[model samples]
Target: MPVLQRIVKPKTHKGKRAIVNREPKLIEDLKDTLCIKGSTASQYVNNAMRDLYDLKKPSAALLQKKNIILPFEDITPIENFSRKHNAPLFMFVSNNKKRPHNLIMGRTYEHTLLDMIEFGVENYVSLKEFKTDKISTGLKPMLVFNGELFDTNHEYGRIRNLFVDMFHREVVDNVRLQGLEHVLSFTAFENKIYLRSYKVSMKKSGTKTPRVELVEIGPRMDLVVRRTKLASDDLFKQATRKPKELKVKKKKNISTDNLGSTHGRIHLGVQNINSIQTRKMKGLKKTMAERKEERKRKLPQNNDTDNSKKAKNN
Candidate 1:
């Protein structure tokens, strides 16, 4: 009768185990729940740990703070945000995990593994990835990025603090520098960061020195110079004034025939001067003849004339 009574106890309902807790108790293996699913507390802790390990990272485009800039367009080009800065951000589920994760989660993307883990562990994950879109969700485990190009250093502490403080306020206080490991530079202005196996050489042959030259063409300056030149030219023209010509009126000849005595005196004066000029001319001609005779006497005369006379006598 004791052996028959041991076989008589009925099995409890499986749904009764679910009713004990408001949240679903994740059972990894239905076949081996007796061994792995310890107490509810232990299972919760194990699930928490597993969620911590499953971190999600953001795409390089979003991680660069380029996403934060206002007036965002869905078109992803090689220029704009891609050329300037880019980085990868990893999201963990809790404060115990590495880096930091944004706590605010989107309702539309609540079905992903990242949302499930974040919701289960009570935090969201942030990460960086190469292939990222609006549908992207979850915690990424690893990331490759350039430290110098990113706004992660002490200089850009404001931006970094802004992001960290916006997400995990408590965990951000404890985030430590893990020493620079996977550093890269995306300063070449490319939308995507590609790994180069060989060294890329850049020459400064035609590239001019970068500078911001200030050119001045103000209206005041232009007016001043132009007015000065115009004023100077006007003054010069004024200084060299030309004299005006006077017009002489024609007068009719009123007879000098009316003054006989005055005409006679004028004719007499003219005749006296002419007579003096004639006398001087006569004296000049007589003096020239005398000088000609003196020159003839001084010249060596014809010894030929004497020779011809002698030759005729002989």
Candidate 2:
């Protein structure tokens, strides 16, 4: 099915500017997720989508209960929705007799379905289950992936990258200790992934750094990995491609080390063998006789400079 494009007739200059700003660029803006609820969405799916939308904050877009199947069956509808909303990432929540409490999480590339990983949500817990204060929306949460499989196994590695891509916010050089309010941990064990959310509590210690503690928040779930449609190597490469402008222009013959020290190679041009006065290197070492000759050579030039200065005065 062909994706339809909607044209807006902007009456004001600001509206026109907004339309123009939405066009594609060399460096795209932070990705917004589309939280979709299928026609057969259960309460568990609804709650999960709500919590995910909270994590994504103002950048998330939602769709009401729609009669739609997942990408594994047919990806055209999913692609259409992605193109219409201009969202690269999506979290689809639905339930069926075959795949109960199914959650399809994936990302799009160039309005096409890139990679879709299906998970069966089990042992679901909602946000209201815990009577703790919720972290403010839009604030970045620290994501921790704790699993040996994440580094060893290829499938778990992909899953780790997906979670990081979904939850990570803009890069910042420095963060305040107080600003770390929440942490989301994805732990893989016993053939299932455990998703846990915690509120960071900072207490006063007798030192400069505060005593930190983690309090259990809600919206937790144990996800059983089901079907997965991974993109090919070439396609995945295209999706993860970075613009040249975004890459730092490297300085020639300069490098850094693990200890964070900047090292550079100094390229020297041809030097005049007679001009060097160093005696440290054997090739440039000056004998006593050579030193005497050098002083004698400088004496005449020094006298000439003094004579020129005197002539200028005259």
Candidate 3:
């Protein structure tokens, strides 16, 4: 009997955005089967594409308008509008230098401006500092909290409390937060806190556990602590300080004057006596000389006498 083979259908697309090819007959069959009307196949294709891409319609939270204000000349904008709208206003500095960007968010315009100054932005003039002539000199588009989705009074207070609580609990407990000597910074996302401490770690082992040994002092650590604030400044300082130097007792040197003492003479005499006894015992021990003497005593003076007597008899 002949072996049978089954035909496999070709897939229309692969990976994320790859183009898919479909049989012309299959497309026509789908249209006819669905009783699609008119030449508007584009709409049907669009809906199918949306389903294939797993895209969902924007929710009310995302659709809501945000309070977008312009920043001062020394400040920059944070393009993450979604995250900005949800949490308390804070400054976000990008880690990437090639795409340098900074963002400030706060409950009010004044609060955000104050934070900018606090975080080392120089020559920043507040709104009051600006004369009517200089009003537009430093202005740029910046995002502020819009009261649509987030209530200014309640939400701002909540965000502030959340930040303070997280800082005290997560950062203070786990890391040494030193005053002036160390810098502590944090970022909040969703319900989690990303706490970072810049201080010398004295741990000697290369493993991940924190240590206090001076030999193990390591570079800065960027840690992600949970929402609960466990870190404290005092605790961190106590843990990371340089360990005390170990004191080793020095060995006492022997005096040359004691070399000729009675005890030393006695020890030398006992050693000499042991050497004489060892020398005497060595003679009594079985040796090659003793074996040669015994062999001569056992062998024949009789053999030579017997040989001489035999020769006389012959």
Candidate 4:
């Protein structure tokens, strides 16, 4: 699809005389069918058409009245008129004006340009010109120079590109998070900074469960650095040694009330000695009695069997 481009009008104060180059009938003819071909194109033709339709009755702001006050000096009558309207101002630091000095505009906020330079511009364009087909509305812009549409070579496309860059720069910067909290880690590379943060809370198992959150900060943007709340247990462990193992093992069976009546270590020691003696002598006496019974029974059986065999042989 052919991209529709827009020519953004300069913002102006109330009741200021301004001039723009446009034709209501011509713009109406090209409203729906043809595409506005330029680098700073927008897909919303509906919006562009609205701005174009409003241009049918141009604002009094673009009237280009004869007398008005401008902020800067060393300027001609044409410069004075352009300054009255919020026209894009292009100036050259050099005398020839061939090389681009700066493409300035009416102060977005006050009576100042973007670079803070307030010099009266050599050339100016009224918003009316961009809205109408009185001038070319394609790759080559219908330019207003000295209050007239000039078909000759001018810096319209370059100025448009510059304006697009200037406006969209903030949007690109805003892709990074506004601020970060509980950042677990961070990294930095060419023209970019990355941050890693954690979402964590105490778990029921007497352990900490951590969730990771990442952020990116700009390479050039200023940041207010702060310490994270999460403590590093590894660092604490490295600094402090483990406590020595306790020699005492508490007996589970002993009640807290009974613990006071008995001396803990002495009672444990006596019980342990008795347990050892009982284990050693437990099976010895039972084995001796069983052996004696077995010998008596076997002797009687042998005598009976020998007599039976002798009788059979005889």
Candidate 5:
């Protein structure tokens, strides 16, 4: 069989396994995003994309002053860039008179545009405006969505899902309290959506649990719903279908709860516990034949006369 392209020989076993996991499989790997900016990108748009790029650094790529590609009209160029970088998610920022301070974000299915949403910036507050310290790089953020429309309206629901898919990095089983360093919040009201970022501050409390506070660290935006191009129902369904191997299988007799303890049931045949061999003192150790003979023999009656004499002398 012909070998695959761009496959490098890894020196270590760990490196080899890492490379193997990168291959296409039934369970898709985490998707990285590409943050792109055009020549017409303004100061506010530039700052927003820059901050987002830094925040998503561990799994995102940034391309600045690149091709003036707009997903609304022609997405081919954007798709090509994404394929080159191996990023399935992308955000394009531009500020022209026609669509001033516009942001287009989307995901790709097989390097083809799946869906795109365009938002016009009403107002923006960059991180530079806030004097708060920036969060640690590569720390996963907690995502929160506010407003009833996000849960009720179909389009709004899609938008909420897209933000989660794009901004959130790899999934994890558990997280530490200190590891939860930041939060990204989305609020929609009166036909406008507001995006906010905050730094989580842990304060001393008289009790065991510390008091928590949210300090706004910006790159905040007041966005107006401008345009949306969604995928067809059939295509979207196909894209979201999970393979059998990726589904969580129920363990045969195992269960767990909120606590760290594990619970399970084990079935076995009836056993003669007395016949089982166990540790013995050196003096008591004996061969199989001796053990059988000893078991057959009976012990003498108690020496009641000797015990009575010892008690009388005491």
Candidate 6:
């Protein structure tokens, strides 16, 4: 029997995986606005989508302690909590009667305490003031940042902003360090704030070819905050005290006669005195020589000599 032949059909090609609908006018408008070729529209959309996605997502490091706030009675418990959780701590002490409430955030309780002392907060209670249970249990909002977008703003943002300002003032402004791109990020753990600063540059990565990267231009500083009195004008005045006037020793006037034969040797060093004396002697000698020359020139033709000779002759 003559065998029957089976025909193999070719697979049909499916176009692009993603499909987006838009008005004809909108598509034309986007093309004109972007100033791109029709063929590159998909590529442009892909890039824009990627950027939008990135904006929507929070930083990985930042999200770890998103809504965590541990409370403690003493440094020992705070230290223990931070160590156990491996996160930083934040404490805000406010006096309703005063303005500029204290915003304290640090890696450790010890660091926070030191910072409080530095801020001149002598009378502060760690546990007595704050209800630790409320904070840890999420009964109340742990952090409240002052700005728009309350929903997006979190403890990390508040702490980052505070540290960035402080870092810029103390390190970039006071120390006058340059090429300080910005505070990359900060970690509060182990009772300290680890602030990382970077100098962003395009440099060669081993090979001749260069790539953009962040180079750490430290001090990866450890910051601390302590409990203190509420912020006030008096506190600011105390913090910014005027520099003490320098006590300059008054130089006693020394008499030239007291310097003896050296001629004011003590007042005007040996070299200076010698120069002065030489200059004076040179001037005196020049004047005396000029006077002697004048006398010699006048001796030949003098009215007094002529009168005396004429009188004698008469």
Best-matching candidate per TM-score: 2
Give residue 227's error in model 6 in angstroms.
17
Point out the higher-scoring one by TM-score: 2 or 3: 2
In model 3, which runs have C-alpha deviations exceeding 4 angstroms?
Answer: 1-69, 72-84, 92-314
User: For each candidate, what is the lDDT?
Assistant: 0.25, 0.86, 0.29, 0.29, 0.84, 0.33
Question: How would the candidate models be sorted by lDDT, starting from the highest?
Answer: 2, 5, 6, 3, 4, 1
Candidate 5, residues 92-140, lDDT tens digits: the string is 8889988898888899988898889998886787778999888988888
TM-score of candidate 6 against the unseen true structure:
0.23
Error of 5 at 52 (Å): 1.4
- Pairs of colliding residues, candidate 4: 18-61, 18-62, 18-63, 18-64, 19-62, 20-129, 21-129, 184-196, 184-197
Which candidate model has the greater lDDT, 3 or 4? Answer: 3
Candidate rank order under TM-score: 2, 5, 6, 3, 4, 1
Which stretches in model 6 have alpha-carbon errors above 4 Å?
A: 1-197, 200-230, 242-292, 297-314
Tens-place lDDT per residue, model 6, 177-232, is: 23323324455543344444344455668986567666554323343444332224
Runs with alpha carbons beyond 4 Å of true place in candidate 2: 1-19, 267-314
Kindly report which residue stretches of model 4 are placed more than 4 angstroms away from their true locations once superposed: 1-60, 68-71, 74-105, 115-162, 165-314
Instruction: TM-score each candidate.
Output: 0.13, 0.79, 0.17, 0.15, 0.73, 0.23
What are the C-alpha RMSDs, in order, of all predicted structures?
42.3, 9.1, 27.2, 29.6, 10.5, 27.8
Which one is best on lDDT? 2
Backbone clashes, each candidate: 14, 0, 19, 9, 0, 11
Lowest summed lDDT window (length 10), candidate 5: 295-304
